[model samples]
Target: MSDCNKTDFTNPSTFILLGIPGLEAAHVWISIPFCTMYAIAVLGNFTILFIVKMELSLHGPMYYFLCMLAVTDLVLSTSTVPKTLSIFWFNSREIDFSACLTQMYFIHCFLVMESGIFVAMALDRYVAICHPLRHSTILTNSVVAKIGLAVVLRGIMLVLPYPFLARQWPYYRTYIIPHTYCEHIAVVKLACADTRVSSYYGLFMVFCVRGLDMIFIAVSYIQILRAIFSLPTKDARLKTLGTCSSHLCAILAFYIPVIFSSLTHRFGHNVPLHFHVLIANVYLLVPPMLHPIIYGVRTKQIRDRLLRLFTHKGM
Candidate 1:
């Protein structure tokens, strides 16, 4: 496979995603549930976006980050969910080579953006709690806009090499992805050419983006916790922590499975295929579903606003 020239485009024009093995035989049964989950994920994230946008009171740094998160979830889910559902529904799991790279690029791009948003949320909480006097001044509109621009530019820079490396790889006649989505590692592994460079680059970007973001979040929360402890009143301490509880929960839910999945893929190759699939799906789906619930339940303002919106709509 490596012997084939990169210029030789005469090989496989379309790649097939093997999809879920057992259910591949029963496409109809699989399609219904997958499609339903996709719809719910999209609608739920869109609702979060709408709530944040419509409620002017939710325009603070916290909600601004939340809205950005909602958008990321929508884009992330959109990139893979529809394609997965289509595979099950129509038994049409074929994706073009260029299309696969595009999907992989967007998936990775949003992933980095999501991490950036999490870091920004942590900083917002830190300012609000630790430096209350300068919260507004520190997280001003101009500053937030700059942060957003930085996040987008950084995300693009981080993932740009992936598609380029992928395009350079020689494709064998066989191009079948085992997973539902166009995962970066999964696609890279299929490259007939030596993928050492691509793999190393991917790992480097993943670590730099997620690793640094996690460290920043950890340090921010440490400062926040220190400030909380310095508070004279227990209620003040609890209140300050409570304000970030939702974001903390979201960060945990989003990153833990992802980190675990990546580790399992790298070090636990002997593990069962089903175990990898289950964890990977959880990493993708669980956060999108849990995010709105975490924010809505943890933040009374969001919950009340949602209730009022539904109540008025009911009338």
Candidate 2:
């Protein structure tokens, strides 16, 4: 009981991660699925990268954006999953402070990058379908390169403050984090000092960066929908919408779990701790695993290439 009440005046050099507060007994069993998802996410994203790189026909803005998304998913998931699995499977819960901050930075950085990639993809589809005549001219290779660069810079600039701000706060409360990964809020809340500024900054980064990205995507899609509807024939509209199906699936796969997890963490006070941890894990793991599969299945070009590759291998 005394240990529970004790506080450390110095910032911890190492923080202990309690994988899931109430689910310790099930950690081993839980690790099976998490491990499986990580493996699949890695394999699937690499396959997407492979397909896009090898297919000359895919040398366009859309596939370039897909490659960006795949790479972001890889980094985002890799930032947390291995450590999480270690906590679950081997009971290796202590993470070095610097390592934790690095993990936090990579996870949020790639998350923002992924959102920007989705917006780029939406714009790609909008131009292709809405203004086919100018699609080539507008989304040229150089323009796509510029957009990618901007996305990378935006992510870096926005998330760079997280670790610095976290470092400044005095973590006298406890060195134990009740989650698998070093989330910004999870780490900051351990500080005994006032954390409202850090907390509000997190909210600001989310709403300002991701919120604006979402708004851009939404507007692009509205314009896309108008263009699709204006098509004279049902088949024409269907064909055009088909091109966006994979992107739409990817967007939902990315945003729903993320938004739910963020809201649950900040606002769902009645929610169980284990449930919150599970949702946080799901938001990171599920999207990466699902994204490549969604694109592979919905995209006819990629689907055909995958089928050919496997069939040739079988032969």
Model 2 worst lDDT window (10 residues):
1-10
lDDT of 1 by residue, 41-137 (tens): 7887888888888998988888888888888887887888778877777667899988988999998898888899999999999999989999999
The deviation in Å at residue 278 for candidate 1 is 3.2
What Cα-based lDDT does every candidate model obtain? 0.83, 0.91
Candidate 1: lDDT over CA atoms? 0.83
lDDT, candidate 2, equals: 0.91
TM-score of 1: 0.93
Worst 10 residues of 1 by lDDT: 2-11
207-245, model 2: which lDDT tens digit per residue? 887889899999999999998999999999999999999
Question: Pairs clashing in candidate 1?
Answer: none
